[model samples]
Target: MSRLPAVFATGLILALAGGAAAVQRLPATPEPARLTGWPQPAEMPGFGDDGTLGPAEISDLTEYVLALAGAQRDEAAVIRAVPLYQTHCAACHGLGGEGAEILGTPDLTRRQFRVVTGPADIRLQIWHGDDGRGPMREAQRRSGRPHG
Candidate 1:
């Protein structure tokens, strides 16, 4: 009859009821729905859907992209890249490529990188995110931008 015992009993009953409801709601096996509207998996410029890229392929692609970048080396190119970088890279890389230490994002402005050594390396990293690290694959897939 005490208020304390009554409250305790009510809590125990609610917890057991909630547990039963949770168990009932759980599926025996999860089957995720396919997103028909999304792009069908296709081989990207420098990589594949499975995120594989040979050294030769990566080198060729890197050279091509760097050449293009070099050709467009001007104020206009920098201006264009700024917005794209902000939209895609800023969340993890920071406004000035300083990187988010908490997220394990490397400082882009540094002379040496944890995973990348040059322009080609940067492209590879951007295209195929480090397996143990975070992902840009979803961003790349959604953006539909051609990757180097």
Candidate 2:
């Protein structure tokens, strides 16, 4: 065989040495993956007809809704809220969660509603009865269960 060039021999040795070092540095368990956080959103479970989260849907909706809070829309919260409105709310609040005038639902016009802040306050409206026009009060009356 022809004598190898000194530069080529040196490079080959260095490459082999670097590769060996890399193999040693690599972890057998891959550092246990560190579990940076929740799995990728694309891996989320699909939302069922009832609008409940599956392993996939839970991951997806969480990502979507959280993303909306920072987005620009007529009301990103309202848009992201479609699922919630369709679920716990549509029966009394109307399809869009727009207050019902006939039932005395509180018109969501910011001008109409009083200054409000905090999630519990909003949750209270959802939990208690916003009988401004919605059937929340009636549901409470008929069900005789907690206002949910």
Candidate 3:
């Protein structure tokens, strides 16, 4: 009886862990999360140029600040982002969307192009250094420039 109970408990634990892993594997959704009394960027200087910046620039700028998970330009997200990249990012990333390894460009091919796993991590990176210079530097650099 003791052996049976121990085996049952182990199986239950394994099942739960598998379920948790499946949950983690699910596609990530990006949305603006609100915080209490956070100051507005609009009110600050050196931002919001009253439409002086081009639309593509606006998109890149937004992507830079959003700090969301799976921030890559996926099929779902690409529908909205490709036009933006074509106008702004293509020059650096290239016509095939292959980022410039020669000039430290980032490949936005996957959900993990850069891991922002949480708000705190993303904030620290944005304010400080991103493994080196730009966002997703570690992931992109380490991956050996795979498609993304």
TM-score per candidate, in order? Answer: 0.40, 0.30, 0.30
> Each candidate: what lDDT?
0.53, 0.42, 0.44
Worst 10 residues of 2 by lDDT: 40-49
Model 3 residue runs over 4 Å out of place are 1-77, 110-115, 118-132, 135-148
87 in model 1: Cα distance from truth in Å? 0.9
For model 3, what is the alpha-carbon lDDT of residue 11? 100
Query: What lDDT tens digits, residue by residue, belong to model 1 across residues 6-46?
Result: 89999999999999999999898977655455434222222
Residue 106 C-alpha lDDT in model 3: 48
* Candidate 1 runs further than 4 Å off: 1-75, 133-147
Sort by TM-score, best first. 1, 3, 2
Alpha-carbon RMSD of each model: 13.6, 18.4, 19.1
Using lDDT, give the best candidate's number. Answer: 1
For model 3 the local lDDT of residue 112 reads 31
Q: How close is candidate 2 to the true structure, as a TM-score?
A: 0.30
* Candidate 1 positional error at 58, Å: 13
